[model samples]
Target: MVYRDYNISIVVTIFISLGLSIININTINSILIFGQNNVLSDVVCEKPGIKSISASGALKSHPPKNVIDGNQNTRWSVSGIDSWVQVDFGEKRNICEIDISWYKGDQRSYSFVVEVSNDGKNFKEIQSTRSSGTTNDFENYELKDSEIRYLKIIVTKNTENNWASINDIAFNMNKEPDQNLSDPKTEPESPFIPTKGYGDNIAVAADWSCGTPAKKTVKNVIAMEPSLLVVPGDMSYDNTGDCWLDIISPINDLVRITLGNHDVDEGNPESLAKQYIDHFKLPNTYYSFDYKNIHFLMLNSETDFDVGSKQYNFVLNDLKQIEIDPNIEWIITVFHHPIYTTATKHSPNEKFRDIYHPIFDQYDVDFVIQGHVHNYQRTYPIVFNGHNPDTPIVTDQHKNTYVDPTGQIYLITGTAGRQNHELIGQANYNADQYKGFGFLNLMLSNDGKTIKGVFYSNNNGEIIDEFVVQKTGAIKPINPDRNYQDDKNDQDNLQSNPLDSLFSDILNSTPRYK
Candidate 1:
């Protein structure tokens, strides 16, 4: 009896050792998707009542923390690393929207690739975009209805501004897809295309003078997808010694050139203007282009608005016809001189304002964007030479420090390749001065709900400044309220400012431009 008992005990011990060896082999094969930890098995943790699973197979009781440290969230800030985060739906769930929020200051550009896997070994890329990029805000995406057990978001580019402080991310899942959110009335199709297509209908303001930086700026803008480039003035810094042709020859095929102050004269002042008129193929130094129902008025700031000139007569005739286009929802006038500039480095051009503001006001022009101050400033939409508290002005006049109400929306987006001027810190604009060499990316959404102006550095692709203009129909002009409240003109009701108490999330730490 004792010998038989010993034999059974030996057999049981051998079987137990074999099971242990099999378990160890499986653990070694499991790979980690992020961090240094090994992957936990789904089968071992799959209890009958488990709801959700995080990176660890333990019961995920709390949501992920909003950790903003660069090292912790390095995926949000830099490039060349394949950093990623994963979300498990517990079971096959239909996801429609994903809301990812960053700290109020962590704006940067990076490409996002989303993937799904039932077995957690393979992933498929869905949608990708080069975000003009957003800082300190939430980016919401309405994805097509998808059933995903494990979802992964891989960050290809590092978040530029924030040290990687991503706050909270929520995966919105529904039993049934909400048709309203699925097909948003406001959201338009993707603005950027995979090919060498212009991102949107808006134009890029470029100046190819001041050496290679200008040439690089033009090429980068073309790559980013601009509908067209509007070189309002100053194609080159100095035209002396016949260097103008060399500077413009390379980019001429890519962009439509417009004459600027430096390009017209400086060396051969007598015939320089004629040389500019002949080479650029412009219709007498001023012309217009109609695209997707938007009218772009490219004017010569030197001639038309300078005392009495021939270009002035041409501008008058051009406005007469543009004003009558009922289909033209937006009128964007580009030039070199600013109508209302608060840059202490350069004074506002009273001469240009007197020449153009009347026509702009009479026609209810949507926006007037110019580049020449070598610094950047935007004014609220106010009438010319008028100061009303209710009016919108871009100057830093109010003690509250927001967009001026009683002024027109004027922008000086000049620093394409030229050196940025030091901001003069004074009482009026001491708090809101940005001196950097950068360019502007102005986008008008197809729905006409928002106008986004993105200011990125010329040297490196750093987005320095951003602002949005919300349109209220002709019913209310210079409304100081925050929200766009609708009012019946006959009923005498008006809404408040759409953005009453908002501030910019992106800070000016290292000025991106030269």
Candidate 2:
């Protein structure tokens, strides 16, 4: 009897060890491997009959057949009545935009409504819209936010009167699409919620680095609850080779990258840029997106800035086409080059200024964002064309002020998870400047009419800067004289404090694992 009892105890011990290993595997895989790759694995459960059951179709929520015709380019036609396109975000996210492409050009009157559900049995309509474009190709649409797990798109009628066909459907999330803010689901065994998230805010660090300290600082900043992460150029030293990729793992899903000059070399001047693309899937080196009512255009400074170049022409055409939206009240441009810097480290990219400033002026661009100089600086609205010092200025909103006749409001925010350099000098339209290693967290109101930029450090949850911009319809109010400009403000030009010393080593080294 004693030997039998001992055997039973040994069996239970072995089982417990196996279960613990499985749990650890799940936790590590969720955080490092599967989640970063945007892939979710199958879940298994025990059945009553002493068998294990595996769940399939967890990520296979593709649109149904006969929903949108992808081959026909003539008209929208429908055949099957029960077909519908469905998207499961794994959880609910702020529905910022939906991009669609229909094969039938000019044939279908694009109109659709969004129906959402938690359990997929019962559904409710959240928002509906008529076609925003004339052609079958439309991109970057705003979506509503709630506790949405399953999303269904149904086509009631089309211009072709047949069926609707689509080639691609891409969606964006404010933060994690699966993160539920109001309530959280947790396992009873663990005290910490596995899927905690940061709200929509940008992070900054006085002295940012890629070493352990910088890594910790960045992780802390991301933990503050930001919807996205924006790192100013100089992300890693020597383009930091492969090392930068690991440093960014914490905020990989919510990152957008712009290359600093340090990212490239004589051989592969675009290597760093290419690496960024390989790691993160952006539409292009420079592209545009319409979130809510705002139009955001990202540019490539290292690329061509002169007229006639492919990149330059693309920018022109992009702005021209974007003007079709009457609802677009604000235009924000992002790039790596600084066109309005007053720092003595280097001169402004005048060639770029001459090439693109006029187009921006013509289109009434409101905000221009750049990185490279390791400091935080905000500029009042001003023009670069050198046409009229008396050009009118128009402020986009109260916190975001611009010149009267009109130029663009240039903001330099490069202090995230990296080291900071002191501001050597000043500029004509300088509004605010700081030396810190942190990031900018921006929140756009549902309509995109108002935006708030919050700058904070991750080390201690200290908010160092904050500003708000409200759209006034007109990007430039039309300046009769060039007299309207915000007061040229200045602050102590101290070197931005470093987050921690350990980060420097990590950022400066090459990546170990691919």
Candidate 3:
């Protein structure tokens, strides 16, 4: 009996040991799995040396290299539907995530499938989704643990035209940690000054595209060596956002932009607005600045402009302050929708005129530059009673010059590259009209009283239009009233000015061009 009891005890001991051993093994396995996941999270999969990239077709100007160049300003563009870009890793890799920064990402949704392949030729679909169309930020897609050496992004559909563009691409490898994964990539910020002085000539143009006159127009603009380039609106026709930037890279740093219908017409208007604001580093949708003796006001016709709206209040307040500043000799307003146009495709934006024309006359604005007409039309120094353009209450118009103009000179210079629309003949208020591709090169005199504008055509270097604006005497400052004082006080009370924040690095810094 004692012998039997001993055997039973030995068997129980063996069972207990097995149980302990099983529990310890599971605990170790759990710890290892957790550690591996953490390590995978830190691994960056985008190692260009180990991968080869190819696209179905890319614009000659925009190549596949641009996708991996780490520059959002550059991009790879593919024409037509079912366009695809593939990245082939030399060897199989454990990929956990993929990130893509798309071109014109702010405006349109894109539908695509992510496929992976072990062999270079045969691919199996792994993931697919419709993008949210946020341009300024990357859209990240997480994948299940899979060994993939070759990856392909097949774009099946898009909300915009039949063009697909990608600014940058990235991946997260699952096996090991990568230092680049820890390094945060960010868009480079350009310098901007809220109120500064500039003396060189300013080049103004709009409606640039990839077509005939656009490239030629940009070439001419580069040769001009102007201190500033202001494109009022309709900067790009192709939804590939980087196309326009690439075309204008030579003068990009010198360029400033305003929103146009074409700019905000795609995808989500709000998303496009955010992207525009971020890409340009604008303080807001509307802001003012001083370049040399000129006070420039950039407005957003796409946004709300009715009285009491944020934009309206900003404009009214901005003009009031500029009216009191003695250094300001000229007030030039720029926006997408023209207050006056002779093109039959689009009529004068009477809504805009009724809202802002009175304020312009009240402040004695010098010039108003606009786009969206696809042609050039300059209105005489005229005032309006909401419906009709009438001669200014207190102004004069001569051959090519205006003396003491009572109203703003409306210049519609939209002929940059897009095809010109047929004009419905000249209007009674139109001082000049032209249907061609060209830009305005305005030279402000040293004395800050004369503005000589020359419109150079892209087709054959012909001078399409030329005019001059001369100020006879000092600009009368708007009378300082209690309301004006209160506005100034409110502006001063703000701890951080939006302009200062948007251009913190460059606001007080020395002018880049000056």
Query: How accurate locally, in lDDT, is each candidate?
Result: 0.45, 0.47, 0.61
lDDT of 1 by residue, 9-84 (tens): 0000000111121111000001112110001100011112124433321113222322222122321222123445
Poorest 10 consecutive residues by lDDT, candidate 1: 1-10
Question: What is candidate 2's lDDT per residue for 96-201, written digit by digit as tens?
Answer: 2345555453444444555778776698875444343345544333333254556666544444443444544333333332211211221112221113221234
Model 1: residues with Cα > 4 Å off, grouped in runs: 1-203, 206-208, 240-254, 304-310, 386-407, 426-433, 447-449, 472-474, 477-514
Query: What would the TM-scores of all predictions be?
Result: 0.49, 0.50, 0.54
- lDDT score for residue 68 of model 2: 27
lDDT score of model 1? Answer: 0.45
Model 3 quality (TM-score): 0.54
Judged by lDDT relative to the true structure, which candidate is superior, 1 or 3? 3
Q: Tens digit of lDDT per residue, candidate 3, span 216-329? A: 677677766677899897665433355677778888778888878656643333454556567766666667777878888888887788899777877787888887889888
Native-to-model Cα distance after best TM-score fit, residue 46 in candidate 3, in Å: 50
* Highest-scoring model, lDDT: 3
